[model samples]
Target: MNTAVPLDAQSRRALLQRISDILLRPAPTWLRIDAEGTSAAQLYKNYLIYLAAIPALASFIGMSLVGVGAFGMRLRVPIAAGLVNLLVGYVLTLVMVYVMALIANALAPRFQGRRDMPSALKLVAYGATAGLLAGALGIVPALGMLAAVGGLYSIYLIYLGAPVLMKVPRERAVAYTAVLLLCGAVAGMLVGWLTALATPGAGLGQRGAATLRLPGTDIRIDAHSVGQASRRLQEAQREGDGGAATRAATDAIGAMLGARIDTGQMDQASRQLEQARARGDSEAAAEAAGSMVSAALGGKGLPPLSAQQLRAVTPEQFAGLPRTAIKAETNNVMGMAFTQVDARYSQQRQQVQLRLKDLGAAPALAMGMASWASSTSESEDEREIERSYKKAGVAFREKYRKDGSRSELSILLPTRVVLEASGSLPIDELKQALQPVVQQTTALARPPA
Candidate 1:
């Protein structure tokens, strides 16, 4: 018989203690959990239920409230849809944990270990503590990748627990863990696919109450529960030390996870800029834009160049070709204003277009543009040749047609500027036309004093 356990203050404290112990001292914690006669129902009711919700609720708040952003575009999942997906994913996670425990018990015999369901459940549940706790990072979408590092750590926990709880020989524990991980990965993919399908625009509509049908069960999400959860989450945020904990965890995880650009800050600054613009507060808007620029620059906190300065660096003529058209403008992206200069030179049927973009304020975009810096490739066919390589400390990509009718050359400067020349001319001619523009833009791309 199973007995229900109420999740009171003591239970919550116990849960936290267990999580910390499992993470910081897995070897001893596994032994303690193995010796305890805890039932699967009690474990699920007191531990897995709350821990799994960390990811589900955090993801809901993140996707629907904080939103997701990249390359100056922000996307927020519909509130009702996000709630629906959260419920579906949460249920799937709980089920998957139990299923994994069952698999662990079944594989115990094959690994020359004891087949104790209770021990298997304890191993799977406690071993997943690190991953479940790390799921809180989903609250900031940009930091979500760091969660995978925690997941990797969970694998290590499982490796440690497999030998303790499952009683598997240390020599065969690696194989046992490998098989379980493969199954877990497949189950995870299925859960993600199903949850995505339940969201709006993913084979489902969000016009009203969302309903999802699973095997032998129908899950319906009403607006009332969604509203209640949102209200409670907001209250918790206002009343709890979640903010401080999140910052501390972020710093600790970042030190282990390495460098990653968080675009959420830029998205928030963009919203502030928009609100300021709505109120016609130019000063506030400028401040918000500056913040956005700083975020985009990976915290370098450099101001963006003005349109006139960018235009001044553009060449009026190139390779004896007269300038035919020139235009300079300031474009706003995610609240950060960037200067771009475009110029065209033409003589007879030959034409070359030069574009100089100041990407100093958008280091993420600049990194993406110059991703081929460490890569080198070349291919030549009967009609065209294409190659990407680094030259003289600059990343360049070039393509030319054998007929000499079209060519393109792109250069990524170290100062975070992108210079490109393309037109109906030879590749050499295009490069020649861009040489002076590249030199000038390189000088102009310096950080503001």
Candidate 2:
């Protein structure tokens, strides 16, 4: 364009048309290769690609982390630093992929063909393997060259391998892979950058705004308490001296926490700031944030907060909790985990219960699967053992639901059994539960003596 001739209208149009032909020229005559109806053959190769890709990605993440952890002395340093770096690198790698791919695609030749699913899967596998190798090698700061090369190489390799995998022209595969990587990298960077920039509340987009409200009433609280605070705040507003009125009402009700602190900032900054500042800060924002000292209890410090004061605490305070309190909090977490594990076992027993329900609803199939109480053979006797397992399973499940905190009766099989043959039910008081029943059902299937 800079070296263009001064042609007007028709002359310029003719020159532009000639320039287009020259610019859009194809490969050298000798280098041109044809696809030859091998599209179907290439698409079927996806299985091999997947065979290579899946294990590589999984192994890279798992093994690398483990390998880093194996250095017990350096574990504290590298593992901690590596994980944070890996997260950042993983994001940056995506950006790199897009840039490499885009240029390859725009400049490379394209050949149109039907998508071969097998070939596509294979291509992904190859690409994944390339990505994994690059990332794993990059873990050794000095060997990071592998990551850079492997990441870019994966795209080129995908393009090169596309023809064999997808049965398309090699040129087309190269072009597509190159462009795809470039676009993908650009997209990844943008997404990561945007996420980094977003404030925790603002990250949820319009939903965040809709959740919390902004108002001027001297006292502040989260949305959960806003409805309750609104009426009282409105009355305070009518009383004219807003800040002082809010303080007077708040001090009178010494237990009300919303009088001084803003709850929204509480979640973001946490309890550290609340515990730190005490009335002498000069900055207006800092001064405004100070909590009002109540003389109700005559200087016995702040009121004692309950266990459920989580909503009132800030994130920083939560992180920097006193050691003993943290351990107590940890126990609470473990207790929840134990409950979930018990629930999982209960769910498995419920599946058996559903099967029992079907026995009552659809007798024919249930009988076929063995709903009958009568023994057909020693093999049929085996079903009784299976039935007992189910019964015990359900019993333990019920016990779990009642009081999972008991900690002692947490197993699927109890120590006591209530083995029933044909009774209505055992009403004996304080019957001790027996231990696990170990009946061999596999041996019962053998020929009878």
Which pairs in model 1 have colliding backbones? none
TM-score of 1: 0.48
lDDT of 2 at 140: 43
lDDT of 1: 0.65
Question: Which runs of model 2 end up more than 4 angstroms from their true locations?
Answer: 1-110, 194-449
Error of 2 at 338 (Å): 54
* Model 2 TM-score on a 0 to 1 scale: 0.24
Candidate that scores best on TM-score: 1
TM-score of each: 0.48, 0.24
In model 1, the Cα lDDT at residue 335 comes to 57
1-449 per-residue lDDT for model 1 (tens digits): 02234678888899889987776445567888888999988888888887788787888888988897433335899888888877876777678778778878887886679999999888888887766777787798755633543454565577679989999987556556655644444444455457666654552222222322111112222333333433443444355545543343233222222213234565466568767877999898888766654552445423677778878877767777788888888776445556777787889977777777776655544554454554576778788988878988899988899998999888988776788887798888778767777777777645455
* Model 1 worst lDDT run, 10 consecutive residues: 212-221
Residue runs of model 1 more than 4 Å from their true location after superposition: 1-6, 70-73, 200-449
Best by lDDT: 1
Candidate 2 residue lDDT tens string, 1-449: 12123447875574344323211111111012122232423322322222222223332354355342211312223444434433444433333333333333333333344444433443444343434444444234323322322332233344445455445554344334423433343344344445345322222211101111000000111222333344454455466654644443333222122122222232222233233333333353232222111111111121222222211121211111211111001111101100000000122111110000111111111122221111211111211211112342333211211221211121121211112111111212101221211121111121122
